[model samples]
Target: MNVSRRDEDGPRRVVVGVSGSLGSLAALHRAVAEAGRLGAEVLAVLAWEPPGGEFGYRRSPCPPLLAAVRDAAAGRLATALGEAFGGARPAVPLRSLAVRGQTVPVLVGLAGRPDDLLVVGAGRGLLRRGLRPSVAAGCLRQAGCPVLAVPRPALQHDLDALHRRHFWHLPEEPVPAR
Candidate 1:
């Protein structure tokens, strides 16, 4: 699905990867806000892999299935953009693309231009390194352009909520006052 498009020769773009995760949405928000400030465009790219097997970042061997998957992913990107911006479109031009591939490779590809700014989310689970690296971490390590890895909003985490509740409900110690 396409988001928005402007002249090809426009200024550099702020490229963002959205995977429907809370962290990705946060990164999208940051990208849009930053793009507005810089008078740049937002290139929102969403990547999707098929249900099974490793289909490298090329034309899907099975086009029919891949088409359906791409459709779903694009639809998701649209919904996510709506939610992230809350009807407040960015001041700068915005374009969204849904491509098939792993997040890191697709985003790294998009950031090939020297002026591109890549933004990704940074909420890999604690201890997740053994299992896998986050897309944000991977892109930051490999991409040629500057990368901004925005973690999901702190308030979205359970620990933060628990801390807020605990603080609000704390028992007060009575003190004798003269």
Candidate 2:
């Protein structure tokens, strides 16, 4: 016999992973839209790990520094939320959290309800290691709920291209095709 548990977590949630990147902002917007469409609440989650990973922190733990890092993570989450919504509240109910852990696990664990929806950005930037598609992939494999991977906004792609050109000191105007 199968036992089904009731979700005590009020409304279904559109759980989004936010990292303050343009891609993440795009995901956040998509999540809000989904929440509105589904009459669900929006749960914006930002995950952070201590500098140099857990092993590094364990080797030389500093409580004060750890506190500062955690505080910074919370501040970044607040800033990302404001930037994502342009300081205007979303029409849907919204809740924000900044947790200390691996991103994929944190997201998957929080969005464990069968009705929950997990949203993640699909890319990062040209000059960086970029969005770990693995986050979305991991969620897809592990989440009990549906996963929505939002593609990076076109503007982000353009900005990344411009950044790439600037990094290489290339002329802004491309050479005319022969």
Candidate 3:
């Protein structure tokens, strides 16, 4: 926990990790709200890597492919911000970053100032846990400033259950016309 007041780092900032997931969208909203309350700026960051692992990229080293991948990532970040803010500017000062790297390290590095508040979505299932490390957990451990791990929205769980039911071919009640 950083107890120091804001100084050379400029005004306080709310740095959020955004990945276009429902949980990340929730975290983005929360970060914006927190920034409003704190009179701070909101920095939305989206981290991505090449299609293949870093080692694979190093082996091939195709500049065009890498450029394409980075463009795609920038597009995704724009789409996410559009979804989060509905094409309108946020009330607070807003900035965005689309970087190439691991999510945890990128986020931790950007929110390194003591007055920075690092926000990330907190949600993981058995399958997800097996697949990748949790960004929230990593930020919590590595960030120099305070970390805000926003819980996954209830609707996300409901949607996941719906997806599972659909995948299993389970019959669900039909919806009536509005």
What's each prediction's clash count?
0, 0, 0
**Tens-place lDDT digits, model 2, residues 19-88:** 8988899999999999999999999999998898789899999989889999999999999999988899
Top candidate (TM-score):
3
lDDT of 3: 0.93
Residues 122-143, candidate 1, lDDT per residue (tens digit)?
8764656568767877898899
lDDT of each prediction vs. the true structure? Answer: 0.83, 0.89, 0.93
Candidate 3: list runs displaced more than 4 Å: 1-7, 170-178
lDDT winner, 1 or 3: 3
What's each prediction's TM-score? 0.76, 0.86, 0.90
Worst 10 residues of 1 by lDDT: 1-10
- Tens-digit per-residue lDDT, 50-122, candidate 3: 8787888998899999999999889998999999889999999999999999999999999988888999999
lDDT of 1: 0.83
